[model samples]
Target: MFKRCFLTLVALSVFATVPASANGAVFDMGEQMIEISPIDGSDYYTGSANAQAQVQNTGGIQRTSFKQAIDSLEAAEVEIREEYAVYTQKYNEAKGRYDVAKAECKALKNNIKQINNRLKNVEKTKKMIFNNMPG
Candidate 1:
């Protein structure tokens, strides 16, 4: 079970270390909203509401923050796809390497699909947020 725990930690580290920064820039959300999270190495959003509600609360910074989240999601999608490709190729090449065990490969494919679905949801959220914003 050490292997399982180790793999879980590795997987979390792989994705969590990637900050969702927009063009390597940080957002000035506020002191209360910008705490650094020890678990993910990201700015921990302290608000009780969802991203849209939080955006609404931020008022003037809504558009930029929404765009930043969208960009971060897109970056994550790309990174997930890159990792998926490597595993897919390995799976195709030998069908076994211990590193790309059959079950692990299947899990990776599922993760890739999940990331794609997440991107779609993010796009939909962006549209909804944009439409609701006051002109």
Candidate 2:
């Protein structure tokens, strides 16, 4: 039937792909990979690959350069973050000191007002005593 025909076609296809020799020795069906050329303007693998050696070297150089760029950027990011943290800490300390100083200034103003009121009272007492004691 149709099933037998399908099985026969599959068997034939498999046998066709299988390499054979006169002595029936099958060599490797090694890695079958496709090589895609680098696209223009892409950050990845770029450089004149006119020769096989150049193409191989381009791959290695591209990877190394890209890795170096990433490492440098990461180092810069870390430095910037550390500096930001230090600035934040300094700002917090300044804010705390400002608050303390503001509180001290308020307390001093209250103390000065109290001292002025006492001085006014003392001046009034002096005037009353002088008015009564005068001949």
Candidate 3:
């Protein structure tokens, strides 16, 4: 139970850190209001006006072609597959070691039980011989 809880906490921590390392910072803008007003008293403007607009680029989005997107996804998939293979191999090796250790533990426990039984029999024999000796 302790091991299970520890592993769960570790998994949660790993998952939590993953999103924290994302590209952009998180902004919490609560209750925003925007109002646009024209300088003219009239509702509509008839004259042609020269307008210049400047946009601050925050590197939020990247425009990519379909082929580029596909290639990126394929590369990600290849990396995922390689990582999976490495982790799977490590898991298999650990499992093999665990199995060997479990078998050795079982054998050691059995040997201990046998030695305890022999000790009990030896004590009983000693008691019997003492009782049979002349008083």
What TM-score does each of the candidates earn? 0.28, 0.48, 0.52
Q: Write the per-residue lDDT of candidate 1 for residues 23-134, one digit (tens) a residue.
A: 2444555544778765874677776864563334565588889999999999999999999999989877785566478789899999999999999999999999999999
TM-score of 2: 0.48
Clashes in model 1: which pairs? none
Kindly list the per-residue Cα lDDT of model 3 for residues 23-90, writing each as its tens digit.
23432222133354558868876898789687767444443466678899999999999999999999
Ranking by TM-score: 3, 2, 1
* CA-only RMSD, every prediction: 40.0, 23.8, 19.4
Alpha-carbon runs more than 4 Å astray in model 3: 1-64
Candidate 1, TM-score vs. the true structure? 0.28
Give per-residue CA lDDT, model 2, range 1-135, as digits (tens).
999999999999878766444224422222224455666786777676776543354888889999999999999999999999999999999999999999999999999999999999999999999999959
How accurate locally is residue 77 in candidate 3, as Cα lDDT from 0 to 100? 100
> Candidate 3, which ten residues in sequence have the lowest lDDT sum?
23-32
Clashes of each: 0, 0, 0
lDDT of 2 at 102: 99
Model 1: residues >4 Å from true position, as ranges? 1-58, 96-135
* Clash count in backbone of candidate 2: 0
